[model samples]
Structure formats: C-alpha cells, structure tokens
Target: MRLLDNIYAGERVSAADAVRLFELNLTELGAVADFRRRQAVPDERVGYIVDRIVNYSNRCVACCEFCAFHADAGMIAPYDLSFEEIIEKIGELVVGGGTQVMLQGGLHPDHPLDWYLDLLRCVKTSFPHIWLHSFSPAEIVHIAILEGMSHGEVIGRMKTAGLDSVPGASDLLVDSVRRRVSPRKCTRGQWREVMLALRDADMVSSATMTYGLDETLEERVEHLCFVRTVQDETGILQAFIPWSFSPANTRMCEVAPAGGVDYLKTVAVARIVLDNVDHIQAGWLTEGPELAQLALCMGANDMGGVLTEELVVQAAGIHTRLTAADMEDLIQNAGKIPMRRDSRYQELGHEG
Candidate 1:
C-alpha cells in the first residue's frame, strides 16, 4: 500500500518497488496501474495508428535465438524488397489511409549505409506525407559498424534523408538477456548509445521490451529502469511498448511462451514504472486483440497500430490483424473514445 501511496503521490517508483509491484495480485496491480494511467493521460481516450511494417529484407546475421523471422544465407533464399516493391507496399498503406510506415529489417551483411539512405530518400520522394517511422537501434548500429561511422553520424544522415523517427526495437535492454538471446546483435550499451544519438539529433522515438525469454522478473524491472533513466536524460522517448516474446517456429521453440495474464501484468507494470514516458502501447500483434482490449483497462492508453502487415510475430505462428475500423470499434467497445494518432502520439482524428 505504501508503494501504491508513493506512486499516487507523484513519486518515482524505484527498481525494487517495481519488482514488488509485480508480486501484487492482478486486480491490485491493475488498479494501481490504471490509477497512474488516468493521472498521466487524464482522458478516457485510447489511440491507435494506421501503419505498416515493411520488412525490406529478412536476411540477418544476428541469428537471435528468439527470432523466427530472420533467414540465414543458406537456410533459406533471402529476398530484399526492390525499391519498387517497397514503394508498392507504401502505396497500399496510403490507400488504406495509413499515415505511418515502419521499415523494419534484419541486419543484412552486405548492405551499405548508402543503401538505407537511398531507400529513405526514395520513400520520402514517393510519399512525402507518410511518416517514415522506420529502423531500430540494432539496424542503426549495424550501419554504423559497417561504415566505420559513429551512431550519431548514422542517425544524423538518416534524419537528413527523411527518417521521421526510429522504433525502440532494442528487444531486451538487459545485457545479460541480450547475451543469452541475441549475442551478435548490438549490446545493451550500444543500444543506449544509439538512443543518446537519437536524442542528440532531436528525433523522438519509442522504447520497447520483449519479455518471457527465460529472463527473471528482476531483469525485466532492470529493463524498465534502463528506459526510465534514458528518458530522464534525453526526454526523446515518446512511448513505452512492452510485448511478450513469441517463441514458436524459432530456435527457442521449446521454451514455453508467456500467457495472457503475464502479458497484462507486464503492461500494467510498464505503465506504472514508465511514468516519464507519455504513452504505453498495447501490442495486439503478439497477444491478440482480446487481451489487448483488456490491456486498455490495465493501464495501456494506446492500442499500438493497425499493422496492415506484420511478419515477424506471424513468423512465430501468431497472426493477429486489425483494421482501422476494427481498432475504432474495439476502443469504443472498451468504453473509451477511439482516437487516431500519428507516429508522435499526435491525435489525427477520433471516432467517438
């Protein structure tokens, strides 16, 4: 109760307090988290975005143990979307009234930094109105390492080329978990450095966490603290998104996946812990719409995006899709106003 009292008194919860909050029953945790959510949001409105995630290439050298989306060179024939193909995808998004495009891809071994810059320029030239919220810190780090450039230089160039914002795809922010799951990908320190670079460039981005990868709850709390610390320093993180890891069809297929209760608890705890971040996103792509709908009451204020197409989680054998209309209806049915938002959490319109 004291923890809840402190949280309600506008005091920042410590890491130990976050871990203890996870020990509370679901109802108690959700109630406190919902209280924090109302204090932060102060509105009965839930926001969703009409966006698309374009995986330009599946070929990845990271070989993360939890990933089912990446293809090794010889395991499967890799394909990179031709510039024309990517344009076609964005065109389809535009036709669906999409305002944002997230160009996510694996760490391809051969692509040069110029290749990404050119793609960003090409997308901007083709659809200047579409918000290009693309790429993760891992991809930026890969580019920087490939080109012998600093992370700041890579982000600066991408910003100039019309990259509106970056996604916080630094899957698990704990170094221990990163070593166990994604050894070849950027380390926790590198991820922080790239985020600092984004802040330096005055570019806003989101923070994400993928739990249930055999990580301890304390490690999960550590991840939240890391995000909060970065937000305290940079103030560039606009949202915090926490999703359960899907292990099917991947190397870690033997691992039992997290269930809906864990997912909801994570969402509620994230909302309570990430007090500095403005928005907390509910991930329907992995958890399905029903649980995501329940997440609205458990502290999440954003339903993420109506992903026109999502392959990463689908590759793990979880296929959940929603259209803009479905999003509006879902939010309204949840007893909240359905507001459409862009990449920066700016309300575009609403359907009450």
Candidate 2:
C-alpha cells in the first residue's frame, strides 16, 4: 500500500522499490503502472511511426554472442550496400509514405569515417525531408576509433553529414551483463561518453534495454535506473524502449526466451520508474501486435515503428511485421487513438 501511495503521489520509484514491485501480482502491478501512464500522457492518443531499416553493410568486427545478424570478418561472405542500392531503398520508403529511415550496420574493419558520412549524405541530400535516425553508440565509438577523433568530434561530424538522431543500442548498460553478452563491444563508460557527446551536440536519442538474459531482477532495475539518471542529467532521451533478448539462432540458443508475461511486467516497471522519460515504446517488432496491445494497458504509449524493412531480430529467428493500418487497428482495438508520428513523436496524422 505504501508503494502504491508513493507511486500515486508522484514520487520516483527507487531501484529497490522497483524490484519489490515485481513481486506484486502481475495484474495489480500493471494497474499501478497504468495509473502512472495516464498521468504522463493524458491524451487518449497512442503514437506509431512509419519507418524502414536499411542495413548499410553486413561485415562486422565486434561479434556479440547474442546477435545472429552480422557476418564475421572471415566466417561468411560480407556485403556493403552501394550508393545506388541505398538510394533505391530510400525510394521504396518514400513510395510507402515512410517519413523516417533507420540506418544501422555492424562495424566493418575496412570502411573509413568518410564512408559512413557519405552514406548519411547520400540519403539526406537526396531526401532532405526524411529523418535519418541512424547509428548506435558502439558504432559512433567505432567511427571515432577509426578516424582518431573524439566522441564529440565524431558526433559533430555526423550531424554535419545529416545524421538526425541515434538509436539507443549496444552495450547491455550494465558492465556485468555487457561482458557476458558482448565482450568485444564498447564499455559502459564508452557508451555513456557517446551519449553525453550526443547531448552536447544537441541531438536527440532513444534509450533501450534488452533483458531476459542472465541478468537478475535487481540488475534489470539498475539498467533502468542508469538510463533514468542519465535522462535527468542530459535531458536528451526522447523515449525508452525495452525488449526481450532473442536467444535463438545464436550462440545462446540453449537459453530460453522470456515469456509474454515477463515482457508485460517489464513494460509496467519501466513506466513506473522512468518518470523523466516521456514515452515508453512497445517493441512490437519483437513482441508482435497482440502482446504489444496488452502492453498499452500496462504502460506503453507508443507502438514503436512499422518496421517496413527489418533484419536484425529476424536474423535471431523472431519474425514479425505490421503495416501502418495494422498498427492503427491494434491501437484502436486497445481503446486508444492511433497517431502516426515521426522519430521525434510529432504526430504526422491520425488517419492511416
């Protein structure tokens, strides 16, 4: 009762309290989270984005254990998308009414910083209106290492090259889990440095958490608290996205995927604790439409993106897709108005 009272009084849920909240009955837990959600977003509208993901290359050096997406430097044939190929993809997105494009790829050992800059320039110069939400912190760190520049310098160059925003990806955000999942990736400090650099550059980004690996409940809270604290200090995170770790078709196939109920509880807890973060997204690309709908009742206010073209999670053997109409219908059925938005959560239109 005290926990519920504190939450209702608008007090921030502590890391310890957040972990304790997990032990409550799932339905009750969801209700408390829903109350917080209503407080944050009083409007009956839920947001969705029409977007596509374009992989610039498949060659990677930081081969994470949980990822089934990248082709190792010598293990498989590598492919890099040419300017013509990427332009064709952007053309497809424009034809589909997509206003945003997610540009991401693994760290290739050969490509210089200019190559990445050229890719961003090619898209932004051609489609000046499209939002280029590209690159992860790890990717930024890789570019900095290759170019012998500071993180701030790399971000400045990226912005000048037309990079609009970054996806909160890579590094588990907890050093223990990060070492377990992606040892070759950048450290937690390195990732945070990149984020601070983004904030200094006056750019926006989303924060993400991939749970259900070897992390404990307390560790999960730590991940959320870390991002919440960062939001308090930087004020640059536009949203928060939490998804389950896909364990199939990777070196961690022996591990089981997190159940649907766990995903719901996670969404609820995220809303309860991340008071500073405005939006909490239901990762429908991995959670599917039905589960994502239920997540709306729990705390999620956004349905992520339409994911016109996605490959990373698919490579992990979890395949799901949805159209703009499908997403709108899902939100309507969940008793919320469906709003089409861009990466910045600015509503483009209400009609599909």
Candidate 3:
C-alpha cells in the first residue's frame, strides 16, 4: 500500500518495489497500473498502425533455441527474398494504406554489409513514404561483427540508407536467460549498446519483452528497469511492449506458455515500472484479441499494428491478422476511440 501511495505521489518505483508489485492481486495491480496509464495517457483514444513485417531472409547463423522461424542453413533450404520480391511486398502494403514496414531477418552468415544496405536503398527508392522500422539490435550487432565496424557506425550507415527506426526485438534482456535460451543471439549488453547507438543517431525505437521463457519474476523486473534506465538517459524509447513467449515448434516448446492472467499482470507491471515510456502495446497477435482488449483496459494504450504478414509468430503456431477496419472495430468494442498512428506514434486521424 505504501508503494501504491508513493506511486500516486509522483515518485518513481524502485526495482525492488517492482518485484514486489508482481505479488499483488491481479485486480489490485490493474487498478494501480490503470491509474498510472491514465496519468500518462489521459485521452480516451487508443492507437494502432497499418504496417507489415517483411522477413528478408530466414538463413541464420544465430540459431536461437526459442525461435521456430529461423531456418538452419545446413538442414533446411534457407530462402532470401530478392529485391523485386521485397519491393512487391512493400508495394502491396502501400496499396493497402500501410504507412510502416518492419524488415527483420535472421543473422545470415553469407551476406555482406552491402546486401543489407542495398536492400534498404532499394526499399526506400521504391517506397519512399513508408516508415522503415526495420532491424532489431541483434541484427545490427550481427552486421557490426561481420563488417568489422562499431554499432554506432553500422547504425549511421543504416540511417543514411533511409531506416526510419529500430525495433527492440531482443527476446529477453537478461544475460542468464539469454544464455539458456538464445545463446548465439546478442547479449544483453550488446542489445543495450545498439539501443544507445540508436539514441546517438537521434533515432527512435520501441522496447519489447517476451516473457514466460522460464525466467523468474525478478528477471522480468530487471528487464523493465533496464529499459527504464535507457529511456532515462536517452529518451529514445517511444513504447514498451510485454508479450508472452510462444513455445510451439521451437526447442523450448516443452516450457508451458503464459496464460491470460500472467499476460495482463506483466503488462500492468511493465506500465508501472516503465514510468518514462509513453506507450504500452497490447500483444493481440500472440495473446488473441480478447485478452488484448482486457490489456487495453488494464494499462495498455496501443494495439500494436495490423500486421498484414507476420511470419515469426505464425511459425510458432499462433496466427492472427487484422485489417485496418478490424483494428478500429476491436478498439471501439473495448470502448476507446481507435486512432491511426504512424511508426513514430504520431496521430494520423480517427473516425468520430
């Protein structure tokens, strides 16, 4: 109760307090988190984006144990989309009134840095109006390691190639958990460095957490605190997304998936811990639309995007897609105005 009192008094919650907040009953925690959400976003509007996630290549050297999407180059015939194919995908998104495109892929060992640069150049040349929110910290770090460059240098080149923003797709930001699950992926420190590089480049990005990876509650709090510290220093993180990890068709499939109660609690706790971040997104694609609607009422103010094509999560045995109209109806059903937003969280327009 004292913690709740301090939170209401405009005081920031400590890491220890965040860990303890997880112990509170779901309803009580939601009440406090919803209160904070109202303080940060007072309007009755919830935002969604019209976007697509384009996987350029599935050939990856970083064989993360938790990913069912990455193809093993030796066993599986890895596929890379040619420039024409990728452009066609973006063209379709453009025709559907999409304003953002997230181009993410695995760590392809064979491609040179120019391959990625040319891809960005080609996409920009074709669809100059689409916001290129592509690449995760792991992808950026992979490029740096392959090209013998620093993270900042690689991000600088990416920005020149018309990359609008980066996505915080680091599965979990705990080094121990990373070792257990995605050992070949970027370390927690490397992920933070890439984010700092984005800040230095004057770019914007969203932070994400994929929980229920057999990690402890304290580890989850640590992840939230890590993002909060980064935002406090750079003010670059625009949104915080906490989603349950899907374990189907992956090496970690035996791990029980997080249920609806855990999902909402994590979202609420993230909202309370990440006081500096502006937006919290409901993970509709992973948790289903109904639970995502509950999350909006709990603490979330964003419904993520109408991802026209999402492969990674689909590979994990979860499939959901939404048209722009469906997004509006879903938000309206939750009793909030659905506003169209760009990648930068800039309001486009909403129907009255």
Candidate 4:
C-alpha cells in the first residue's frame, strides 16, 4: 500500500483505509511510524510533567456508565475541598515540583457557577504560577444547564475567573454513542459548542478520545475527523490524546480495555489523520510506561504527564504511577528526548 507515501505526504485517509495500515507487522509499522514522527516533529521531542489531579468533588449529576468516579446522588463522603484544603494541595504539588494542577471534578448538583469561579480565582490567588488547567466542556455544559445560562456565558465567566484551559474529556463526539454510555450528560453538539466558545475566547486546549468500548473503528475515525475539523475551524488545539476506556468500577465493566496493539495502531492512525494538530499524547496512565514508550516510535510526540495524583483512571483500575525522573528514564530508554512541558506545549525543562 502507498499508506506511508500518503501519510508522509500529508494526505488524509478514511478509517477503513487507515485500518489496513495497521495490518503491517510491528517492525515495519515501527519504522514507518518513527519516520512520520521524525518528519512531523524533528528537533523537538515528546515531553511530560509531574502534575496532580486534585478532584475537588465527586458528587455528580451526569453519571456516565463508563465512569467510576461519580458518586451516587445520596452518596455521603462526597467531599468538596475547601479553599484552605485546595491551597494546601497546591502547595504540596508545587513543593514536589509539579508545575500544573489538573483541577477536575464532577458536576456537583448544588454548587453555583461562582463555586467554580471562586475556586479558580482562589487557586490563582494562592499560587499565581501554578497552571490551573481545569474542567471539561461536558462539566461546563452541565453547569450551564443547571444554572439556566447559555454555554457561552458560563465559559466566558469561567475564563474571566481564571481557568487556564479546557481538559480533553469530551470523550466520544457522537451523541448516539454517548447516549448509550452517559444519557444524562451533555449532547455531543453541546460539548462542541462549549469548546468552540472557549476557543473563540482565545483559550487553546487539548482533545481526547476514549476507545475500546461500543465504538467501531469507523466511529473512532469519525471522532478524529471531528477533532481535525474543529482544530481547523478554531485553531486552538494544542494536542490530541487517545486513551482506552477502563471499565473497572463503571457499569460497563463487562467491556474489556483496548489492547496494546490496538492502542498503538490508533496512535499511528491518529498521526496520519490529524495532520493539523501539533502534538499526539500517548496515555501512560492507561497503557503503562512500556507501551507508552513504544507509542513514541508509533508517531506520538508527547508522553503525557507524570500525574502526582489521579482519580478517574484509578477509579477505573489501572495504577501506573511514575515520577519525573522515571518519565525521563522511560523516554531515554525508548531513544527519545525527555523534555518537560508546561500546560502549553512550550518546553519548560529537559533531562537525560
């Protein structure tokens, strides 16, 4: 097949066409994938940072069947981190050398929009340097619906209140699929609308995909195409991250996680498909460091972050934790430069 020729020449292919490219053996695939990576990001290398995911609240209204972190409606111990408590967590993260704080949480039923705005302001006020790269479009949509406000208004208010950027958790961009898993959540159109508003306001963010559930390969490609379209339209995507769905504590535990081969294949296809995006982030949290390192050869330019703390995945079942030094070692062992990056893809530091 002329797959490598088209990919190297920067031609988009359909998902059906892309699947044929994955049929090649590991050695051949690795060579082509590595060549593509070199072509895309030559002098630059994949980077990651030691950061923490301090989920402020687990009480959720949009209970996704695939999510294991959402607490039940009457579930007690669904603690909301007070301003003092969150500040302490940020202090610890900063002292531990974490430059970013992934402040994610569920859609707390009663918390006003000011609750989140106040949280963002408090985080920025307490630690002026810590990047509060928090919240997903889904969460924003949920809040807007509850507050009886438009998506644009909620996102504008949050951006003014000091949200750094959106997290890549829009999941499937198709509503039929999302309804199967998360009926109560925002529609796909709503999610995209929220992201569009954020982009229009000049806040760039990352996009993500969670595969290996009920979605087909064609659907996955559709998701990628949607991302590419949005990136082209908005010009605000910093990276693309594709992760496997972990069915641990979720209602969909019967569905198996995506295998390493499938994960690498998707990453390779993503590189070929999303030609406009600058970076492709491989999920070490879901695929482990070894497979994540292998993804570097399979066209991924970012090794994601060394999460000092995580909940969504932990709630799912996988536990692959690493330090900044460990991430450096992984990248070095994989024969790629280990550069540290801030929330944006700007190189913050480098290590051997």
- In order of listing, the candidates' clash counts read 0, 0, 0, 0
* Per-prediction TM-score to the true structure, in the order listed: 0.97, 0.97, 0.97, 0.94
Q: Write the per-residue lDDT of candidate 3 for residues 216-237, one digit (tens) a residue.
A: 9999999999989888888999
Question: Which residue pairs in candidate 3 collide?
Answer: none
Indicate the TM-score of model 4.
Answer: 0.94
Model 3 ranges off by over 4 Å: 73-77
Candidate 1 lDDT, 13-104, residue by residue in tens: 88998989878889998988999999989999898988999988898999899988888523335778899999999999998789999999
Cα lDDT for residue 67, candidate 4: 86
Model 2 misplaced regions, further than 4 Å: 73-77
Q: Who is ahead in lDDT, 1 or 3?
A: 3
Clashing residue pairs, candidate 1?
Answer: none
Q: Which stretches of candidate 1 lie over 4 Å from their true place?
A: 73-77
Overall lDDT per candidate, in order of appearance? 0.89, 0.88, 0.90, 0.82
Model with the higher TM-score, candidate 1 or 4: 1
RMSD of 1: 1.4
Model 4 agreement with the true structure over 1-352: per-residue lDDT tens digits: 5876776675777667666776878767777776766776886477887788888888888888888887763323567778898889889999987898888888778989999999989989888888878888878888888899988898889888888788868688877788798888877777678778887778878889988878977788888888888888787888899998988778888997778998988898787778788788888989888899889888898987887768778777677889888988888888878889888778888865
- Determine the backbone clash count of candidate 4: 0
Q: What is the lDDT of residue 229 in candidate 4?
A: 85
